[model samples]
Target: MKKIKVMHIIGRLPVGGAENLLLTIVRNTDRNRFNLIVCCLDKEGQIAEKIRQGGIKLVCLGTTRVRHSYRKIRRLVELLRHEQIDIVHTHLYKADFWGRLVSLLYGVPVICKTEHGDVNSFKNKPFYFKAAEYLCFNKILDRLSDGIIFISEAQKKEFEGKRIKMKNSFLIHNGLDTKRFSSSNKRRSQDRSEKLSKNNIVIGVVARLSDRQKGQSCLLLAMRKIIERYPEAGLLVIGSGEDEGRLRDLSAQLGLDGSVSFLGVRDDIPELLAGMDILVQPSVSEPLGVSILEAMYSGLPVVATNVGGIPEIVRHGETGFLVPPKEPDALADSIIKLIDDPAMAREMGEKGRETVMSGFTGDIYTKTLEDLYVSLLKRKCRNRNYRYADLFEIT
Candidate 1:
């Protein structure tokens, strides 16, 4: 049988959960069963180059912004037609819009869109304005898409309640490469201590320094209290974004210069996670966090804000601790409690690793996706046969 050709479209192939998910799918899927190509709407990131290095074809439309790019859309349609793409799976808002539009124009058989975050989260004015152009275009994209993929049940509920006319919606949680994370054991404890210092009980957070969604300021405030109680407690923030300066200023204002280290855009995430006794994700909003799973697989206890699908992964007292969003005191208390009790922290970390090994492995994720693909293809074929029968007046 001829292999199915899938072209994945994304706004940008950055070091993010959605982008990482696309990479996992491309890398793990059976090459004999599917031919995969990546189509990025904007300039490619480091992750895109990694995809290219893996012998996968990547195409960028060179769109600087999402505003009324008809020329870019036309070029994309031409590329899809020329490449004979069978399926166009889009991620993020801009690619979801333009990718679906061009896929329809090029007569692609399968059109799928994955919702990485709750679209309703943009109902607030500031965030909506920040992403206004994409928000304006999403209605048309939602209508054009054949299947809508959600990373979590919360994401599906939020989008479905928003009255998006989705033809098919499915919840597919993000998966981690449990074996690789567990087996690598590449964490250099001495190097980590050199970076974090031996005197401090390091609490690490791996996220883009975005204030709107990531709530980094809240984490910093919590860290302020944490350091006051345990003077040796320190925070190691990884990843960089627009809010870095403000967060740094907030730390300095809190007199946490010596206690907090901002390691921007780190390449050693697994090692960083391994070095920490606890991991924190204080996101005000999140669809589902792949970082949580990665941390868990690295045997680090997690303390995350209770928001959007985090509860689904971190069972309150079992796997990790969950605290209310934007509550610095609660966040601080949870971290302190976990930090003070090494045995409890170790137990939680072990349970978290078990959860990932059992449910969140790359093999399981790829299998589930492949099964969904097969099922959708069969359904499409059945519908096509029905249409053919109706047209020909044959049974």
Candidate 2:
């Protein structure tokens, strides 16, 4: 059988959720059945190196500073033609715009774009932010993207609210390498145990410390409240961005001088997650929180903002608790509730881990994506469309 030649175009391969999700797909995809190539519209960051390390082909345009560069488009078009790409799968806005335009021009069989939870794009962000090269081009651009995938149903519904309809839309939840998380937890258990005292509690958050959206300030304020009750508690701020200095200032202003630790971007996330007692996501808007799932895989109870697709995952009183965004009081209260009741927190963490294992593993994510790709190619071929269902029959 001839392998499906897939070319994934993206803004960059930074250590972000969308990049990580794309890497998850790249690493987990059945290589024998799918020949993969990556094209980054901007400079290749850390994850791009990891993709190349996997022995896959990759290219970085590095034309971010060159505004309206036709050379970048020409290069992409040439690569698509040279590779005979069957599908062009794109992630992020810049890539979506160029990928769709170039794929249409090159007569690629299909164009698929992953919608990585921009619930705040239209409604929450400032008008200027929305105006700056935004792709809410709605139905017009949707026509070119043969398949539009929403990482969460909340994101799809947000788009639907705008009456934007497109062909070949689907919902595919992101997944984690639960086995890797499980093994890492076992190995790091003894090490993390040494840091834990009988009265100590560690609250953690793994998110980019951006100026907007992530709501780290809210978590810091909540930590001040947590300290009043559990004085031994400390907050672990993982990842990094432009807001680090401002967040650090806020930490000092709140008299949480030593209570919060900003570790910045670290490669050993699985090991770090092991050291956490409870995970909190205070994002004012999140299509879905990948860190929540990662924490769940590591057996940590989650406390997240109730907005977006989070309600679908947290399940209120079941796996974890959800609070309204920006309310430091409510956020602190939820965290305090977990801290006060150790047995309940453990039970919730156990339940959360079970949910991840049952539904959101790498195997399930890979198969669903592979099936989607096969179906898209089959639909085009059924012009004698091939049936992805048939592939399942023989395998």
Candidate 3:
């Protein structure tokens, strides 16, 4: 009756959906049933610190900018063997490759991978370098792991079409902590009031400033149109990345200085979401967006691009408006409609909160994950016993 040791591996413990999901798993999983360990491939980011603060063991592989180091792989294998890891669950691409390979080398029984994004979208890459990286990682994913977990059914179907022979692929949507996200928190409410004065309508976007994928430029263009009409409407952007400087310049060039506020790499997401009247996710490409769920749980209506698994979350007319990716004009129109009609926005936000409470709560996500782990472990045992019987017959 010993507890199983589950190790989660990821590329980097950055402030992203994958990292947040891992953090929730570590925090919520029954400690009596499973001992959790985190293995981050690169340098630890803010989320890594949060995991450690929660009293979990975190091991960083210390991989520099270089890719595919066999020495680090061997070291990881040794760590797994010494820890007697019962299950190796990997997130993102690099971790999926190296973690599964090392787990197999260490004779770890259960290996599972979570596909947080669609691999097919790599085809849309304009640069040869990006396309090459995708091709290389796609092969690595096929070669590693026993089971695949996707954040959305859209992601699963994309993988299937690519001829990836995963025997067990399951769809488990991302979840949020509804209580933590609720607007009742005194601190969040106070902060919201301070940031957004009573009369101002705040439209916010929370994402890393990555021009290639996040489509921040498209959002800026959309904001130009929004400001042309509702000059009082303010925009608050949270999070920072490589594209911050360029995005800032673009905002100024579009004469959005006073109206647009860039609050980079914020830790106060719940407070920020609570302050917002509408949440916008203008991603050229995205998987299952946890931010959308968080906004919904915070009772904020969303306006997002109709890409990847976005349609799965945002019911076009019900929860929020879904515009085509890279369409700044369409995005502008949607935002204007919602801003003009406050009552409609409030109704949509209420419905969104209901959807999140019923389906996307963190408790439900963790329970579903636990069930999946137990089922996979049982199947592994059954397969092993059958293999033993076959060996005996041969002997």
Q: Which predicted model would earn the best TM-score? A: 2
After superposing candidate 1 on the true structure, give the runs of residues whose Cα lies further than 4 Å from its correct spot: 64-68, 121-137, 164-167, 179-200, 386-395
Q: Give the root-mean-square deviation of each candidate in angstroms.
A: 4.5, 3.4, 4.7
The predicted structure with the larger lDDT, 1 or 2, is: 2
Top-lDDT structure, candidate number: 2
lDDT of 3 by residue, 1-395 (tens): 56777899998977887888888788788777778999988899989888998889999988824344777877798788788777899987667667776777677878898887677554443364355465665455455556788888777787778765566788888878554554473334334333333447789898878887889889889998998888788899888888999999999999999988999887778877866888999998888788899888777779999988888889999999999999999999999888777777777877887888888788888889888887777676677763322221110
265-355: candidate 2 lDDT, tens digit per residue = 8878888888888899999888888889898888788999998888877878878899999999999999988877777777787889889
Candidates sorted by TM-score, descending order? Answer: 2, 1, 3
Query: Which residue pairs overlap in candidate 2's backbone?
Result: 381-384, 381-385, 382-385
Count of backbone clashes for each model? 0, 3, 0
Query: How would you encode candidate 1's per-residue C-alpha lDDT over 264-299 as one tens digit per residue?
Result: 886567767877877899999998899899888887
**Candidate 1 clash pair list:** none
lDDT of 2 at 229: 88
